[model samples]
Target: MSGSLRSREREMGVVILDGSTVRAFVGDEEVFNRSVDERFAALDLNGDGVLSRAELRRALETFRLLETHFGVDVVTPPAEVAALYNSIFDQFDLDRSGTVDRDEFRSEMRRILLAIADGLGDFPLQIVLEDDDQGSNLLQQAVDLEAAKTKAAASGK
Candidate 1:
């Protein structure tokens, strides 16, 4: 992976540990991608290509630790979490294909990071920044996003 891509992944809360373990860190909360994938796969009932809102809600119930560790109150009456998951799923779906494959999942991660970076005022100031370094960084960002998506898909999240 490119150095720029690696840097972006680090910025987006992904930890590339030794032995190829990829973990996600949300505000000091750590979640293993493999574990999350297993949990989500178990929730994908009906052997369908996608997870319905109901299925996602059930998955959220199982993912209680996420809320606790992340310091995010995502789990509540269950319905609320379900709704939130539905929205999240839609955002991750990207192409609105009702299913999020590896590519779409990675794109969603990039979008999430971009949103956070934008919120933090870390992005470029100008309407359009013209520079090779900036262009290379942008390319690296895209590469990192793809890597993340591939990891997520392989992990089953």
Candidate 2:
């Protein structure tokens, strides 16, 4: 694959299962822990075992804000975003309860987090490292090319 394509793939967090553990990879480097259960607990808004659509929506909104503020390229379309919420609602409405409690919420949250993380490409750390390297190289090349151009201009040639 071309380097640019390979790098783009690396940017999209790809989780590979290694035995019982999940590991996120960027190129040859492992970046994220792939702990969906832990992440779900941390994001649970009400200290309940389950996560509701409101909580999930809050999380997504926060993610969107971070992406915008930080200039992150991850983008979720409006339709897909709605579908995601609907999927969670359907899953957590177990027993046709028409409402999600702690357990149901937690279960759905775990699945949603995993799915979102999976699509987000490597964890933030991995992306940062990769971008740092790429940025440095581009900067250096730009500097060198500018210097050459300057020299050519000076020679009036």
Candidate 3:
């Protein structure tokens, strides 16, 4: 698998594939740990045990901002980036339900952060709930979050 960053130039790198395999360089454990921690905190906005799709989408927004601020070359466009994370979210939601548990959320988020650390893609993702009630809860949160982002952007904030 090819990576966005030259392996020789960076202490850590990632090789992401279309399927389940997302490889991260464990060559620098300390850096990798720190990156994962920081990324996780940013995505778990409610400090809840699990992450919603809304939270993951917000994380992607930050990723896009950072990439632009740092002048990093993005191989994927914004729409594709959104679709990628959406696809990941579906996969991470193992139960076909609506919410991802803490363990699953962390694992997928780590994979995404690893890819981003290597400048591969705008990655960060999450969960599903099985019950109709719980699924509605998650869906509401997603709608609300998306609305807030739109409003904020429209107001130039």
Candidate 4:
């Protein structure tokens, strides 16, 4: 019930979505890959076509993304934070290659998203997503995909 939440260029707003919303996103391979790949590319600061442990950790530190919950700070010890990030990095490195290639990253991301969708169940969850350029905008892409589908169906009729 908040104002529109969009990219940095647009006024910040909040949108409500649920399990079905995330399901739609994962179902649309084109939209999902494009959106998620953009994020992976940004995180691959070395331009190595893969994400190293340092790269992933740097992203977390720079963004403090996992630490703060919608402006609420959850203070954690540095050692614990490092371990958490290490575990996260390990999850993404599906092949245990010490780096997360695009495929590995994509596969891991898919699993994570599916888990989130399952957990959300039938509840309408409101969230503010940072710009796709800066952060994950999964919900926005899901909404846009559905809107495009509706528009296409209308035109076809």
* Candidate that would win on lDDT: 4
Backbone clashes for every candidate come to 0, 7, 8, 2
Candidate 3 error regions (>4 Å): 1-34, 65-85, 109-157
Candidates by TM-score, descending order: 4, 3, 1, 2
Per-candidate TM equals 0.35, 0.33, 0.37, 0.78
lDDT of each: 0.45, 0.45, 0.49, 0.77
Cα lDDT of model 2 overall? 0.45
Give the runs in model 1 whose Cα sits over 4 Å from its true position.
1-75, 122-157
Error (Å) of candidate 3 at residue 28 is: 6.7
lDDT per residue (tens digit) for residues 13-129 in model 4 = 577778888888998898799888998898889898999999988766645554443444566677988888999899888889899999997898789888988998979888776
**Higher-ranked by TM-score: 2 or 3:** 3
Model 1 / residue 114 / CA error / Å: 1.0
Off by over 4 Å in 2: 1-17, 22-42, 46-50, 60-80, 105-157
Q: Please give the lDDT score at residue 77 for candidate 1.
A: 72
User: Which of the predicted structures, 1 or 4, would earn the higher lDDT when compared with the native?
Assistant: 4
What TM-score does candidate 3 get on C-alpha atoms?
A: 0.37
Model 4, runs deviating above 4 Å = 1-11, 62-70, 132-136, 155-157
Cα deviation at 126, candidate 4, in Å, is 3.6
